[model samples]
Target: MTTHKKIRKAVFPVAGLGTRFLPATKAIPKELLPIVDRPLIQYAVEEAREAGIEQMIFVTGRGKTAIVEHFDMAYELEATMSARGKDMSALDATRATPGDIITVRQQVPLGLGHAIWCARAIVGDEPFAILLPDEMMIGTPGCMAQMVEAYNAVGGNLISVLEVPREEVSSYGVIDPGATLENFGGALTEVRGLVEKPPVAEAPSNKIISGRYILQPEVMRTLENQEKGAGGEIQLTDAMARMIGTQPFHAVTFAGDRYDCGSKVGFVEATLALALAREDMGAEVRAMAERLLRA
Candidate 1:
């Protein structure tokens, strides 16, 4: 029972209008927004790849063709790079080996659950993953990698979670703990229930769902007729909540930094943190930060 299931496919919901980002996002997808040198969606895809996911399914919208192309081969660009004998690392960031990707249009501004449902045909009967690109999780093993290990151990639905302050619980999907274990200097709790953005005073637990999830494909079927919840749009949390008691669900307390890059402030923070982590930019960032502090 401890054998790890090879979860080979992952669905990425990228259909949002990204209204939060305004005019800049008017043309460019917010998922294409760069954290440092890479787009937000690239970070999520890289995380899935690290977790052993072989196929990436992106649920996109009209303007999101760029997203599919971003992961696709740039033949002319590659030819130029090959001809120049250049490092080509820049081009490498945009290219995934052929046949590794699939893209479908969401066609409407629906909820997260709806976006996931759009990819149901390709996912089939296998257990799959859903990664929110806007939630950039940085770690040694990456967020999904850690969750995949936990999924192997638990053999059920798994959601990456982190303990947010009680006040912040209202801003996320909070988990109700049944039993807990400590590992890798972090806590893993057996989740009995989930409340989506519950009131601060009524939250069952302070642990909030971090973006990474290894969900049973049955959930996609459940979403087939799922009614709208929480803001009149299909809510993935609501669908996941219904799977309680039927499936073994747990909250994996991950060892990482979770950044909500969909917002203006969080995006800037990710940019600075990632830039400071890079060997090339670290020194410049340090000096400029110091100069800014002095000024």
Candidate 2:
């Protein structure tokens, strides 16, 4: 039996050029784009923190300096806000301890596998999390926290899965399930296999892998020698696929709504949904949304 250790580190692969968002992303990293007020990456970081993750390892690329600055303390800005009697509590989540955050440059846009491989040094031997900031999962308890709870009971490697329509299975890494375990009032399926973007007819199951993952350290070693799979780029799914039988692998069906904020439509949807959920602006936002629909 494998002994499960506490997860203390998380990797955020923000190296993507964000070509989907084009000009806006050409200057600002997509992870830094605001969903409502907080940037996309902050949500991922907050989720990790809520899961008791102490260290955040960001695999960044060129022109992504803003992300580093965003998490750093802004002495002048904070001083100005304090002098003006502005509430500084809201910025607390963005601040990190001196050594809590680590940034490594991917140098090249190889793939998610390579990006994660880049952080292997920092992650060392612990089981770490990988959170794609673009995938915004909203729920009472954050997705990573939920996964951590499940991880505590059965720990090897776990990825969050969601039941998408059968027709939509081709767009994600479809899982071949083995056995199902009850967790957090949801189901955790033992992942027998993973197929990246399989055609609908060939899909093993409609349970698609979401962006949250609690991967063991051995995955990094697999990724190191991983060849390009699916998309001519090193695929994380491919690397993870290699680690299946070696350890306990499971997929937790996330009980929440996930927004693919990497796309324009998803970004707008997340912004509107988050705005409508806010106590200070819910009524006004809902009223405007209703009026806009009628118009």
Candidate 3:
């Protein structure tokens, strides 16, 4: 039996050029864009922390320095807040211990697979989780925590999945499932392969691969010489598909709803959803929303 090591590190691939949001994303890293008030990246980091992860590895690229600084200690800012006698507790969630945040330059505009590969040295031989900062996973226990629970039971590569309309499968990377892993009641499915955005007729399953993943270190070896797939870029799905069957790969269905903050529509949806959920803002926001709808 293969031993599954404890997952202590998480990789955040923030190297992508946010072309979709245009001028808004031009100067600001899309990961730093706010959903309500908190940035999208903070939500991802907090989720990883909830999963008991110690090391936070960020694969970043050009013009993304603000991301690293966001998680750092702002001595001057904190001191000013203290002098002003203002509550400074909120800054705690925004800061990380000096060594906890490790940023690696991706250098190139490669695909997700290449971006993940940049963190292999930092991830080393341990099993690590991957959370796309733009993909806001919202839930009580958080998606990463739920994925960690399922990983403990199965002990292999695991990716989060959720059902979508069959017709909508064309817009997502769907999973080719074999059977439901017993004991989890149907929450865990044995993933035979992955199909990236297939047409409704050819799509094998309606279960689309969401943003979170817990992968073993051996995947790094496969990615070392991985060939470019769709869009002539190293696709993470291709590498994962090759490892399926050879390793115990399963699709874990998390209870959280994933919000894609990478798109304009998703950004607005997430902002409204999260804003309305906030205790301080909920009532007023809901009233304003009702007024707007009525108007």
Candidate 4:
């Protein structure tokens, strides 16, 4: 097993305008939007932490300070809860050490690659992971953990991929795959090429790069000179594509459910799916679901 540098940090790009969310996001950052009770960003951070990521670097933008605050200590709320003798367990996930959670301002909505480049100083010269908060990954060991396990075996760039409808390939970074590594039981495959939101007709394959990634530090240098590709922005796909043949690049097909919380319908569907799986709400939610379906 090739031992790779530990993936101690994760970069979260939460600078989007959330225009699709409208008035709700007009005031609240979309990351702060809750799936059930906890915010979307919280889930993403927690997943990273569970995967042994020690540091969180959030690439923020204007009007995104709420995301930084969400991870900070709620002194007044904690005090009030303490006074009322209420369980503080629900707020436990929000607590972060003073410097453990760091934020860097992106200043512009350049693109995914630019947002990541903004955190170059923080990420430094080591391997790190990128987790998109809007994509809620639900699994027993977590999406990050699964990727980490695969990284331990291969020690290179590993991205999560899902087989999306061919027409939807234009909405995501499509992967052009080479031969599958049979040693990993066909779960891992060489990344032959990457296209950022390619035309459906020109797409290399139906598999889309899901939001999670284990990237190399060299990617920062590539993004520094990365020209805007698809969508007239510095797409991360272009940067990753440049690194494909130079180093080990593979994709992991996620073996769990992933909810695209960025969309209105996806958000509602994620809520119901997760709500029904919760121990406290399962029975009631299931009954409610059945009733609603009948009506």
Candidate 2, 1-295: lDDT as tens digits: 5557999999999999999999899899989999889999999999899999999999999999999999999999999999999999989998998889999999988889999999999999989999999999998689999899889989999999999989999888899999877634547889999998899999999998889999999998999889887668899999888899999999988888999998899999999999999999999999999999999
List candidate 3 segments past 4 Å from native. 1-3
Full-model lDDT for every candidate: 0.88, 0.92, 0.91, 0.92
Off by over 4 Å in 4: 198-202
In model 3, the Cα lDDT at residue 43 comes to 90
Candidates in order: C-alpha RMSD to true structure: 1.5, 1.4, 1.3, 1.4
Candidate 2: segments with Cα more than 4 A from true spot? 1-3, 183-186
TM-score against truth, every candidate: 0.95, 0.97, 0.97, 0.96
Which ten contiguous residues of candidate 2 have the minimum total lDDT? 179-188
11-66: candidate 3 lDDT, tens digit per residue: 99998889998888899998898887788899999999999999899999999999
Judged by lDDT against the true structure, how good is candidate 4?
A: 0.92
What lDDT score goes with residue 37 in model 1?
83
